[model samples]
Target chain A: MAELDEIIHQPLRLRIMAALHALPASTGLEFARLKKLTGATDGNLGAHIETLARAGYVAVDKAFVGKKPQTTVTATAAGRGAFARHVATLQEIIAGKQP
Target chain B: MIDSQQASAALNDINDVVHRVRQSRIYQNASLIIVMWGALVFVGYLANYTWPPQGYTIWAVVDLIGIAGSIAIAAFSGIGPGAGAYALRLLVAFLLFIAFGIFCSAVLGHFGPRQMLVFWPLFTMLFYALAGLWFGYAFIVIALCSSALIVTAYFYAGPALLLWMAVVHGGALILGGLWMRRI
Candidate 1:
């Protein structure tokens, strides 16, 4: 309950997780593009990524993309594991009570 | 700029609509594919009755194959969300069989086994080529090769067209499976 609660209870972080989880590895701008695609602002997206990084659900690395500060982010193995568990819980919710 | 929340909500709505549309298409196409196939069978039956071969029961066999093939398609459901795409491959394979049945029935009245069998591999090469638009070259090549082998082996026997068709779909399965790897 706590983990699933952690995953879906937050709005911006949920969007961040969902977007990156849906795609292959992506940079901050790519994540930003996804956020833009998914309808989240730069500030909101950055905040969520930080939250996920703090929670060890995401890992961020700083680098330069064409001389511009590029922050690359990926779901950590733990984060992916947590997301899978969260999804199973979601599926259980959709299925409604063990048959 | 669009409101992020609103855009997200709109996209969610769009996803829902797309989901419904896809379900509708699978259902509608299930029926449509059967009806189209049924029409083909009906024609085959008419040909059987109208052009009664008397000695050879091949027409009756062709008619039965047509009915059975269409029913199989309806039963298969051509893939769905729960099962992923493999079931679709089966459905498509059945469809290729249905195509083969049509080809067989068309020449049922007169064409011999050798000539009849040739249609599958050569044309399936083309069919798979066109399938390349939807499926690609590996699938096309697999279909072409498989169909050719079956036709070659049974080049002398009964309706060998189905083997060629098997290649079309066998290739599709092999190719579709590989293509799915990239995705």
Candidate 2:
């Protein structure tokens, strides 16, 4: 059985990855919107996002929409691949296909 | 340390996230756009009957108004990145459909504005179906009903056809928007 990805194993990060993966490739969600979806506090969400970014699992892009600084997060191709593998591993375990 | 129980929990977590995202109002902006255009078309058809001699002029004004309104709504539709990209693609598809319709009409020459009315609803139905499929299943029902209305309009022409289009196409969009909002 494939091992779980440590980067995506945390509950909050897992939810974040799941939401991003649901979208089409190269597409992203705004930071505020993501916070609403994940129900995570700003500091908590930012920390997990930072960890994922460091692991090359997600890409964070910051820009100014007018004068307000807006941050958008997209799952990298590597992140998507890792998430897929992680999900598959979970499924395998759930199905009792892995000992 | 992650056993089957943990695995099951993770799967549920993933499912919850996907469900929430799908259920979110990411396409609210596009939905409102549809409602706006539908209203314009409805009012335009009503005006066509109300002023029979100026049918052509009424339609021209309606088209111009529609173009302007669409530009305004599109500018204000504050959508997130992913949903915004999808909406942009839909816009491209809509423009392409209009171009194709115009080309075909020019080439065919024999097909009059009445026939184009029928074609318009069919195209609109197709677009609604695709959009509904992407956003939610409610739109699929709207698409199927619009198809029925399209068939009805095709068989009956003149004032009666316009009325039918107005009632069905316009009604679907208005009602669909309300329904989405309620959800």
Candidate 3:
């Protein structure tokens, strides 16, 4: 949950995680569509996504799709576990738990 | 300075975690919509018997198409985008509409008075709603507009249907556009 204090609350980060986690991993264009779906811009989505990738919570692969360089992102096992605990923590807090 | 780096790292992690949860929710919502639509289609078929024509054969064929298409979509969700699958959804929905027109006009012709077909718009509306909720808001809105046109042509005539259809289409697309923009 303390790790989540570092991760979840930012708008763009929330969106990138939401996108990658859903498809597990998808192309940069796919992520961009999700970003648009969640109303975030390219720079914003990239920066937040980079932060997660750097944390080892997400893994990003850069590859070629036809002639274009594409990035695909996926959540690590650690990332999934972290997210579940974070949700549990939030639920606990909602049910009147103290820090 | 050290605290600032730690804070930034913490925030990034939080975002990563929460976003995954949100996407999972969207996936779950999509599944629910599919289930609900299947149920609706089944019930609609049951009600189809009340109409003038009891051509179980054609209705069964139409129902198979619907059921197969729904299963294909459900299966495709697991296999990622499935290439041109999204476009196929639109094509399938359009074909269904044409079949609906043929079925109602030709087979159900003996419904006596046109007033009894009041269920036409209602049925089409429900279909569009199912498609919209399953596919996207745009699909539902467009389907509603198209189906309304069919209803108008059959039940009413002249420019009134045209004017009303314009209004219906305009309102649906406008509302859907605004909703998408909001999202």
Candidate 4:
């Protein structure tokens, strides 16, 4: 059985990764939007996002949208691949098929 | 560091996130396009009924214009990649349907723009049904109503047909938009 990705195994990061993975690669959710989706406080979410970024799992684009700050977070190709493997590993564990 | 129990919990969390993503605003913008085209086509059909000779040309021009507007809206909507890709596919399919109809009209040499009344709503409603199933419930109602309208249009002649199209297609779009907004 494949080992779980330590980076994606955390509860909050897992939710973020899953949400991003559900979207197409070229698309991303804004920071505020992702916070709502994951039910994370701004500081907590920012820290975890920073962690994921440091690990090269996601790409963060910070720009001005009509004056206000907009941070769009998209899952990189590597991030998506890692998330897929992690989910598959979870499934294996649930199915009792991990070998 | 996640064992089986935590792994199960994590899986559940993933489901929740996925559900939230689906519920995001990325897909809501599709309703605006639906309403726009719906209103446009209704006006076009209404113009046709009001002016007989000029109605066909007006409807054709309006239809093309609506397609162009939809393309622009889809381009700038900031919708997710999946919905964006599906919109592109839908456009290609719509164009092919139109092309096939034109070819048939050319071959028959003076029947009618059967594609407009007959195939247009049929294809539109089919996509609506699919989108409704994927997106929300309002679309399903629109799909059924449009299907009924198309059937009714098939029997009606000339001005009456356009009237039905206006009422049914346009009505569904506006109503669907309103319903989606409530959701």
Each candidate's lDDT (Cα)? 0.51, 0.79, 0.53, 0.80
| Candidates arranged by lDDT, highest first | 4, 2, 3, 1
Evaluate model 2: give its lDDT.
0.79
Write the residue-wise lDDT of candidate 1 on B1-183 in tens digits: 223343345345434433433433343433344344434434443454455454136445654665556455555543334333544565577578657756664756455644444443355456545654564344455455556554565644344334433343344444444433332
Lowest lDDT 10-residue stretch of candidate 2 chain A: A21-30
Question: Which stretches in model 2 have alpha-carbon errors above 4 Å?
Answer: A1-99, B1-5, B67-75, B81-91, B154-158
- For model 4, residues A1-99, the per-residue Cα lDDT tens digits are 489898899889999999999986768888988998899999999999999999999999999989999999999999999999999999888887763
iRMS (Å) per candidate: 11.5, 3.3, 8.6, 2.3
Give the residue spans of candidate 3 off by over 4 A: A1-4, A19-29, A63-70, B1-66, B79-125, B130-140, B155-183
Residue A63 deviation, candidate 4, in Å? 1.3
Q: Which candidate order results from sorting by DockQ in descending order?
A: 4, 2, 3, 1
How much DockQ does model 2 earn?
A: 0.37
Model 1: residues >4 Å from true position, as ranges?
Answer: A1-3, A24-29, B1-183
Q: Taking candidate 4, what TM-score does its chain B reach relative to the real chain B?
A: 0.74
- Of the candidates numbered 3 and 4, which has the greater lDDT value? 4
lDDT tens per residue, model 3, A36-93: 5556777877887788887777877788889988776677877666656754555445
Model 4 lDDT per residue over B45-74, tens place? 788778868856896798688777777777
Worst 10-residue lDDT window, candidate 4 chain B: B108-117
Error of 4 at B39 (Å): 5.3
- Among incorrect, acceptable, medium and high, the docking class of model 4 is acceptable
DockQ of each: 0.03, 0.37, 0.15, 0.40
Distance from true position, residue B139, model 4, in Å?
2.2
